[model samples]
Target chain A: MEKRITFKGVWLPLALIAPQIVITAVFFFYPAGQAIWQSLFIPDPFGLSMTYVGLGNFEFLLSDPFYRASFVTTAIFSTLVTVVSMGVALFLAVLADRLIKGSGTYRTLLIWPYAVAPAVAGVLWLFMFNTRVGVITWYLGQLGYDWNHVLNENEAMGLVVVASAWGRISYNFLFFLAGLQAIPRSVIEAAAIDGARFWTRFRTIVFPLLSPITFFLLVVNVVYAFFETFGVIHTITSGGPQQATTILVYKVYSDGFVGQDLGSSAAQSVILLALVALLTVIQFKFIERRVHY
Target chain B: MVEKRGAGLWLTHVGMIIGVAFIFFPIWLAFVASTVEQQAIVRPPMPLLPGDKLVENYTRALTSGVNAPVATMLFNSAIMATGIAVGKIIISLLSAFAIVYFRFPGRQIFFWLIFVTLMLPVEVRIVPTYEVAANFGMLNSYSGLILPLIASATATFLFRQFFMTVPSELAEAARVDGARPMRFFFDILLPMSRTNIAALFVILFIFGWNQYLWPLLITTDPSMNTIVMGIKQMFPSGDDTADWPVIMATSLLAMIPPVIVVISMQRLFVRGLVDSEK
Candidate 1:
């Protein structure tokens, strides 16, 4: 919406916007352009020269088994992280919403984890599940199950997923609690009067009401798992135990920085850019619908 | 809540207690490990209570432990976080004011340009961004840590959203009073936006403090490392037995500032999260 009254002056506005425009152009747009441009060319080894390969890098990425595997890994990782975190959060939010007292105390205790960095969260979890000194690993060993993420691929993936999901629970819990509280208590009370059990009332009257927030959190959690879980994977597993835990973002860093495969990494970056653009579109579309509602 | 409480209320409390315990367990374990001596932690299932070696472990970590002292990393982190939070707030506030308050050429284009940045995060364009930083000689510096991270479209949009809600009559009245644009902005709009600016500051401060990959890529020097990235470097390479007590102490130290901000400014933090995401 345009303001009905705006001051007349081009210079002030220009001066005001200059900083944002310059930073966006230099840091954001320029590098984005470079990523797109460099994706089309392959650099020869020995840090020498670039050859125009057009679609060769993309084709290589698509055909390569490992690149394809990372796509699958990313999907699996995001799904697992989203579901585990959101499920636990929903359970806690429902319990918190039902409380008459102590909810604020519970919330304060639960929400501090949101301030913990994903990388730091990973270290905490890593310490818990570390091979030798890990308390959880030691307990599991007493149960006759040898828990070693360092060597086992599934264990490695599990470790990273848990670590990533750990900090995320606080965020999802906050949103879910807000959503749950927004639901009319009268509706649930009416359901109770109609002889509905607590579980039945939640399933019939509450779950549908919470769907919008659920969908919103789903998108946010997936986007988070896609991009922000880099630290979790880096600290916990390093995408180890035979690349079993390497999500797409991790692969971009490893290939581009560590392996020096510029073309493939740039191609991967372009592909990821497309993925984020699609997700952002979906998110905005959802927001638009919510606004209309 | 609908029915009289009996077993259900007790059950609810139990469930919440369990949830809180689950959330707090990992941090508690880290705190426990941080207080103990190295030998106590190296053994399986370290002591649950706080140990006598708290002073020793924390002092070691803060003074002369690991890759670089934790104190230096904390100082670097504070600077980067403050720089990013202040820089983004200023640029975003000015640009958002310009976009909302001025009818200018290419206003729509500028908005879309900022909007497009919302799509691609730094992770997608890491290599090229790294090269850009290197070309600008920004690596291993505070500018490298803060500048590339400060073009936040979220903060800009949040300000723009806030500005659009401001009554036009306020501006009209100001203009009628012969107040210039800058004067009106400073006296009227700035006062009105105090809550939003404070809210965005809380969120942005946490974001800047928690940064990992950017600092990891840019800062090669240990002296320049932020606390979040510095912890990873504390782990001894090549299996010579990591100093668990010191590492845990550093981990606890890394979380203090952000956690304090969140707990103290919780209302603003929640408002910022909901608004910025919107």
Candidate 2:
């Protein structure tokens, strides 16, 4: 049966695959390979001389305090954003699951922010945090608390996290809500009959059943924090107040695009790629089994 | 017990209402701020109601300096999104049909390769893509903005997954009717997969419209900027007194298309999520 398949039928798939393969090779594979290549060589901006420096770029990154801080910042940012967004999403999803009325309306309203483009979300948050005109700033000022994210490091980080969490909660909520709805009501009734309270029922019944959704969301939210939050950071502070909020990807963007240091930027990207790949592998290996699906 | 449960439900609804308000307030603020004067915006105790400056702010944002015209940006975004959506749907359908219906060597490997690309985001290869675009002289061109993103791995993967759920008997029936593969794909499979296609279209359109970094990077000319990039350019560096109302107004304007698309396609959007599970 397999041998009977002919070239006449295969041509369309082959043709379809051709464009994808070529695009990936040129845009995805080639660029990634070149980034690795550039990482090994130091390029002089004036003379355009590229000299090979084995592990020198890596050494420079390791030795630099700013680069070191980026690793810590990236870790904290990704983890906090993922954990908080997932928690809020799960909380809302559970609440949404139990509601008898207005559930669909609530779901739609909740997911509205997810529909807003990240750029728009960033801009909106920027305005909301604007010192003079920002609604949040005005509200904080009424309480005699001066909140200026532009100059303070901790405040800047806090604002970014809040904005990131707001933008992220929608996507996470959708997934968790779906996951919650997938759970059979009969299962919850069984627990209810067994005299399980809300917390007890959630712990023993709902939470484990929602594990796969949670795991999937965990990985996705982490990756999103690493890659998607660049626009927010760029728009909000431009990594300002002396590079306080510059995560790894933003650092890569600034170095390569703004600073015009392609070699170091490429090197930084390589590090980021490795870090992401490691996290991905770890999630698959360790967390995959824990996921119910 | 039933009365207590009803009370709990009421409390839950009340809490969710607050949550909804929190989610919506920023957007509402943007809309309200767009209508207010700059001085009024900075005034203590911000106005919760719509202001009189809506027309003036909208006018200034539309007529702003060096920014791509709002009409042209919308046109460009629509053209790019349509091209990408149509191209992706076609490519995905063909490839998914092949993976699902055909008995081919190395089929699983090809499928896996596409799936792996989903995890590897465009950010990783952005620098090299810039160079590739420059090499092809696509910089500052619409082709440059739309071409690289045309063949999406995620779309292909999604279609393949959806097609797998489609019964094999249908394809076999088509072949029994003397239908060639391409003919069956175009006439049978394509039409049957309308829901999946619609879902993919909404997803891709939103993603393409929301795209910022790549478009900003490739399109050096201000004229080529998309709506998102145009909003970004509104903030001038080293300028103390930036135009707040114009910025808010433009950002609000930029959001209208995607918001419209999402509201209209809400059913398809929810269906897409359900389909992903299969």
Candidate 3:
């Protein structure tokens, strides 16, 4: 049924699309262009002089040990957090799928964490892990373990990873649960009749079926671990205990806003953007083929 | 076979119980902490039981500083979420309608554009977005906070996916009866898409309300802050101890709207997912 495009149809779409293009141009494209432009020049805050430093910002980043360390921390943090969180979320989703009663209650309660704003979640967790007054700190003290996130680099990284994982599990669980429920019970019954064990059934049948959902979560979780932990890192550790938690996005924030090094900050942002884009391209090009859907 | 099936179900139940407990523990701790006094909160052995200071905490959190009046912050958050919800739905509906119904010149390109934007997180473009808002003199204004985010790629994508499922015969019948495109969309399509709209609304509302980085960058004035910003400010710097009770109180308060929406629309979400699959 080939429908002819009418005057009203054409005009209405143009009218509706105008605002989106305008807003995207102003807010997304223009600012992105400016950030790229600013990355090339060092702007003196005190002297109010802008000087061209072709590749100097990137060169400075490569030369500086602190900036180099930040890349390592971000890579380790994002990879480890994404794997661990997705693993736990998948486990929880499969478990929840088999529940015959109170499934809705469990789903609602489990997803409650996603409702807590990231900033507030950071504050809440930081309060719990505080050396003097934190509940977790007190519990650790009872076991004769000196647990201070402020002083211990390993503990600080652990705290950030755990907080990031906990904060995001709900969203992953939602998708995984949906994926799990979509699998047919008849297929499971047939697999069981063929003498397959629970583990065998899941690994051979369910896991393969849930691959697309898992892949989607993997991409989201990776992006989140890279960028979304800014508020958490800022509030909890301030990239402290020897800058152990200063990931790329946080570095960009500190360099640009707090440290007033706009050029360096812009350079860091470009690096972050490039890293994310590469991951996205890889996921779409290679990994997406393996997705069952 | 029956006995083995029962055992497997029991094991799954146990795993789910533990999983549910792990998820809820932090929220439970937050609620307990909110009820305690500041002194008790900072003690070496932190208080686990609910304290008698919930009211005092609420009072202090409500009247802390000149920056965010509790009522005003709530109002601002509400306005931002509502505006985004209405704006996103309208734009997404119109755009989705155009892509699904009208065979335009750049329809496929437009569709791909929205999908590409889905992968482009705000973190990448935030610096420039800040500059854009500044240029337009939208800093510290609601327009800055709401307008930039109103055209969500996720919403547009979701609507396009859902709209594709609607039978073209319905639109054909409407057009045959002398109904124009806009009239066909309004009269024939919208009523049928109430469920998808409701689900998308809840999702978009939650996202809009939870926005932090962009809003923080653009809104400098304390009075213009959202609930998340208000909570962040409650954490005092330097040697000054943060008041835990007030922080927890405000945190719990900030969570209420999203919680309410999620609970109320839980059935709708599940139903919509099922229907969309079909």
For A112-203, candidate 1 gives per-residue lDDT tens digits of 88999999999999999999999999999999999999999999999999989989999999999989988998899989989999999999
| Candidate 2 Cα errors over 4 Å, as ranges | A1-12, A279-293, B1-5, B63-66, B103-113
Better TM-score candidate (2, 3): 2
lDDT of 2 by residue, A1-293 (tens): 12233334456666667666667677777788999999998888783599899889989989999999988888888888888778887888878888866788898788777777777888999888887667888888888989899888888888787788888888788888888888888888887788888899899888999877777777778888998888788788888767888888888888888888888888987887787777668666754475453
Fraction of true inter-chain Cα contacts (below 8 Å) kept per model? 0.80, 0.45, 0.45
Per-residue lDDT, model 3, residue B70, is 64
Q: CA shift at B252, candidate 1, in angstroms?
A: 0.3
lDDT for model 1 comes to 0.92
Q: Cα-based RMSD of the predictions, in order?
A: 0.9, 2.6, 3.0
lDDT of 3 by residue, A211-260 (tens): 77677677778888988777778778888889899998887877777887
Per-residue lDDT over B71-188 for candidate 3, one digit per residue giving the tens place of the 0 to 100 score? 6677778888888888878877877777777766776777665655655667776666776778889999999889888744767767777776677778767777888877887887
TM-score of each: 0.99, 0.93, 0.91
When 1 and 3 are scored with DockQ, the better candidate is 1
Going through the candidates in order, what is the number of backbone clashes in each?
A: 0, 0, 1
- At residue A243, what lDDT does model 1 achieve? 91
Compared with the true structure, what per-residue lDDT tens digits does model 1 show for residues B1-278? 58538998899999999989999999999999999888887888788898998899999999996989999999999999999999999999999989988888888999999878874668888999999999999999999999999865988888988999999999899999999988989999999999999998988899899999999999999999999999999898887888999999999999999999999998888877877775
Candidate numbers sorted by TM-score from highest down? 1, 2, 3
